[model samples]
Target chain A: MVKAKIYVQLKASVLDPQGKAVTTSLHAIGYERVADTRISKYIEIIFDETDLAAVDTQVHSICDKLLANPNTEHYHFELETME
Target chain B: MRVSVITFPGSNCDQDALEVFETRGHTVHSIWHKDTDLQNPDLVILPGGFSYGDYLRCGALARFSPIVKEVVAHAQRGGYLWGICNGFQILTETGLLPGTLLMNNTLQFICQHQYIRIETANTPYTHGLRVGTALDIPIAHKEGNYFIDEPGLRELQDQDRIVFRYCDADGNIAPGTNPNGALDDIAGICNTTRNILGMMPHPERAATDSVSSNDGKQIFRALEDYFTTRA
Candidate 1:
């Protein structure tokens, strides 16, 4: 079995309003020297497939087609084996 | 004209869309998201509301619903399709329309009447309205900020697909008048063929003067006139 963890975030050029709001609150609470802060989504998926190569391809396709919007967001994933 | 409104799991504006179509003297059909078969209609609309609770980003899950395939087919066959608010999000997710709606720059769910300047009256929804006419319409959403890459924006402009832009009362396009930080104050856009239109404003909410400005009703009137001319 393979488990996958995906991290999705808005592209560098896109403005992240939610992330900016969080940063503003952090500043209000006295966090200094913080130049920037961005937010991302963490998703986990477990696959029953034993073929590592095939599982990797499947996970990438899922991220490209569903987990992220290619227009404004970028995504990367890590896979590992579970006992 | 016959109108079909698709009701997703959380569509709150389906009834309003139906009523408006009926009031315009058109037959209306309500279709569910899970249903595969679609009734033939002069226009198909995807109404507003938090479809699938707007999980995993707005309009992400709802775009995969079975009925969307039929809607795509209908649009491809030269039928008219309009998506309002959440429906507009679904169109971008389904690739029926270009660009995407992002979180509002203020990070708040804004609900108010806004002024939108008509950019082009070439589509069935805007054929009767003159360019530069400002209409008072209601917009209610947290993710109505439109975004498209620079090249994409230029392409849309070149094709004249941008149908409406958020503007002030006098139709001046300026940063101060932009409710949401959209790339170009874009409020509504259509496909290159002008058949599919996706907009952030709630035209149905402003269809009656009893509650709010009826300037939005001009959209329906334009459609009726468009169909009459074609017939």
Candidate 2:
């Protein structure tokens, strides 16, 4: 089995209000050293196939089609083999 | 005019949209998201609410609904399509409309009456309205901030596709008047074809006097006029 781990985040150009709010909270709690915070989503999918090449293609396709929105987000994925 | 309102699971405003049209004496149909048929209506509306409980992002999951295929085809055929609030998010998800609705800058769900200025009267959706006409529409959403890339923003401006902008009662566009931190204070926009509109306001909620603001009726009237005059 192959497992795909994906990270999806708003494009750098887009504003992330939730991330900003977290940063504000951190600062309020005296974490002034933190420069910024950008929130992102992490997703994991397991495929029945063991082929890394095939899983890579499928993972990319899934991210483009549904897992992430290309308009405002950018996504990256890593593949790991599972016994 | 024949109108269809799509009802996705958790859609709360489907009936409101249908009631508004039915009261206007137009034929109205409620199309389920699972159905592939659109019933040959002249207009299709994706109503407001937390579809799929807004899971995986608002409107993201709902865009994959079977009926959206027909909705896309309908828009391609130049039929009128309007996405209100969550509906607007779905339109963006489906790529029928550009840009995305992000969470409000305040990080809170905002529900209140907002004044929006009509930016263009050239589209089928705003045919009879004059530019800069302010309508008292109600907006209710957690994610209503509209964002687009610089090039996309320029294209929308150059093509005159920005249909509505959140503004003051006096029709001034400013940050103070913007309920959400949308780029350019945009509240609504249309496609390059000018047939599809995605707006983050509930016109149906303000369509009757009982709602204390019938300003939204002007939009419905403009739609009816578009058909009646063309027919």
Question: How large is the interface RMSD of each prediction?
Answer: 0.6, 0.7
Report model 1's interface C-alpha RMSD after superposition on the true interface residues: 0.6
Candidates in order have lDDT scores of 0.92, 0.93
Q: For candidate 1, lDDT tens digit of each residue in B1-57?
A: 989999999999999999988887889999999999778888999999999999998
Ten contiguous residues with the weakest lDDT in model 1 chain B: B203-212
Best by DockQ: 1
List residue ranges in candidate 2 displaced over 4 A: none
lDDT of 2 at B114: 96
Q: RMSD, each candidate, Å?
A: 1.0, 1.0
Q: List DockQ for all candidates.
A: 0.90, 0.85
Distance from true location, Cα of A42 in model 1, Å: 0.3
Candidate 2 chain B lDDT trough over 10 residues, lowest sum: B172-181
